[model samples]
Target: MTINVIGIGLDGVVGLNESVRQIVERATVLVGSDRHLRYFPNHSAEIIVLEDILETIVEIRQHLDTPNSCIVVLTSGDPLFFGLGRLLVTHFPPEKLRFYPHLSSVQLAFSRLKIPWQDAKIISVHGRSMDELIQALQQGVEKIAVLTDHTHTPKAIASLLLALDLPIDYHFWVCENIGSEDERVQQWSIDEAKQEIFAPLNVVVLLRQSRIATNQSLDLANLPWLGIPDSYFCTYDDRPGLMTKREIRVLILAELGLQPGQIIWDIGAGSGSVSVEIARLFSDSTVYAIEKTAAGTSLIEENCRRFQTNNVVSIHGNAPDILHHLRPPHRIFIGGSSGKLRNILGVCGMRMLPGGIIVLAFTSLENLHTALSWVEERKKSDRSWNYRLLQVQLSRSIPIANLTRFTPLNPVNIMIISR
Candidate 1:
């Protein structure tokens, strides 16, 4: 009833220690992939190919019931690191299992490149979505090590990075067949990487290039933070102060109840002030800034770079027209909706997660009434939403002729709807 889950390096059986080698030799039942089992062709143990994980678990359970039986499950790299060891431990009793881990492929790859990996972000794309990889890149990490599979190869990763239009420069290192005689490590630029194919088993490492200092260094310390001065943002020359005011933006952010890993949408994101702040507040979250005007979209991009908010993605298109293409959001902020306020609200209400929050900032009574009517209509059918309205009127102090005078700013109506 005893089981030993051992990790094997890419070098195969030769990489095992004496104790692990003896355990494998004396095992009554062996479980692993076909490639792993081929390493012990002359062994007399009962070999089970791990084609279906569920079926293999059932088989292992049956074998454990037999008296005086020893089971050894072999996996690549560190068994507990995105490997079968953790899964087996979850299904089986912990006291009955023992784990012997080897250097992980991530470690071997980093070692081959002579790079310190303690600070590097490690991710695995084997039989998983590439979204996590994209998110990591957007976070502006200095270095990353990605474990890739056949479908999510190094070349595909390179193409995805290029498509995102990432501002930071990166050098891609493709490490293939690690720890074996046929091992290969090659460095490539983003352009050169997309043109070549790599072995199915490989690790893709992205190292950000260091930036050179210039006159622009003075602005680095003045990066905007929460409730940043409105003057910091670039607005249309003719339509200055068009963006959300600092005071109201702080309130809207508080109402949205931002959380880590949540997806947020900023419709009609003028200059993307709100979206950039949200990305900064929730560094792990994804923020999509949907703006229609060409100038507005350009401003958002410029602001994102200026603020070093790489997590914010600016979509240059009208909302409700392009909302269908984006992932469902946990929080949505509507700054300007043209006349489609009702339609945009409906789409957001439908796509937002249950218990999600939606906040709208309207300067016109017509838009405010439109939102109120939509909420009232939805309330009749579904009572799950809670609504609150706040009107903000403020004045700023300006010094004139050695005397301070108060200048009143435009009033805004904020409508918050939460499910």
Candidate 2:
């Protein structure tokens, strides 16, 4: 028995090559959606409409059990790219299945727009939450290609983006019925897209507009590992050094062990220095900068705009209270907890995913003791809990008259707790 998984685009049978076409023509059992099966009305194969995915796999196996059975499964776009090919492969042996991939709708969408997609972030909202789309937008991706479904339509996505008040300016392109005769590619602003209806079969492309000049340079490409300097952030005039110093920020990020696509929470994100840096360092991750103070929240917004760090979402509310609404975090940085360090730690511990990390930066001995006590309490409950403490003292060279002087920064106590 030989199972051939063929990928078909909107062009349908006309897009198949001779080799793939022969495979489909010779198939004794053809598996595909009603729409795809209609493309081969003259074929002699027994057409099986895909309804229940697991049931379909069972049917495929039943055909394969017979001698000299030739089965062909038709899927949309590249079979392995968010397509049914991956699922079929898992069910059948590698030697029994052969794959013939067609260009994905995402590829077609980008081709229609005449834009390079190498750097674009590709996401699918089909049978998934709209949160993926929001996360991509928040990441400050220059270009994004989204696959839409019946529920997560272009209009629904547009409405969400508009409601979120996305910090970056983006031009939305809706590519409908790609490769078909009635194919349409329309570019609109977010406001325009929200009011318009698009075909069920469509792809949405988001292209971020160029940034305007500001006091802080938005050119993040050439920055070093430590990220943007503290001077770049918009701190309160009265509290100049309120933001995390560059050295401490670097160490905290290292200890947090950030990975792409992870969700991070920066509680007490003052000036959003840590949040902005995390966003920049991990472009695929989403950062929530939670601040209670009005001044801190405003500074965070200002710094995010200045750095063009759209991925860092600034939440203006007290911790633990607002933490419940956010998704479980992979990494959390507690930079300021007011006097509620224990409560914040408790909420984060409950909400963090297994193996998630929490790093707390404290300037006062009292907060450090509170965090240490919390860690001790957690260890008693869960012996698998591990923690470490590091004291970082940084000094920078400053030119005084004709001589350079070293200015020592305040020592920061960092407590890392991992589950």
**Whole-model Cα lDDT per candidate?**
0.83, 0.83
The parts of candidate 2 lying over 4 Å away from their true place are: 212-419
Residue 77 lDDT in candidate 1: 87
RMSD of each: 18.6, 18.4
Compared with the true structure, the alpha-carbon lDDT of candidate 1 equals 0.83
Number of the top-ranking candidate, with TM-score as the measure: 2
lDDT of 2 by residue, 150-192 (tens): 8778877776665444334568899999989899999987778
In the range 1-419, model 1's lDDT, one tens digit per residue, is: 78899999888889999999999999999999998898899989999999999999999999998998889999998999888987998899998899999999899988999989899988888887665676666455778999888777787787776654443456799999989899999999878887887887888998865321111332646655577666555555434446787878998999899989999999999988899889888889999999999989988997788677878989999979899999999999999898898999999999999889999998899998998889889989998877899999986653222234455557989899998
When summed lDDT is taken over every stretch of 10 residues in candidate 1, the lowest stretch is: 209-218
For candidate 1, report its TM-score.
Answer: 0.54
**Model 1, which residues run further than 4 Å from truth?**
212-419
Name the TM-score of candidate 2.
0.55
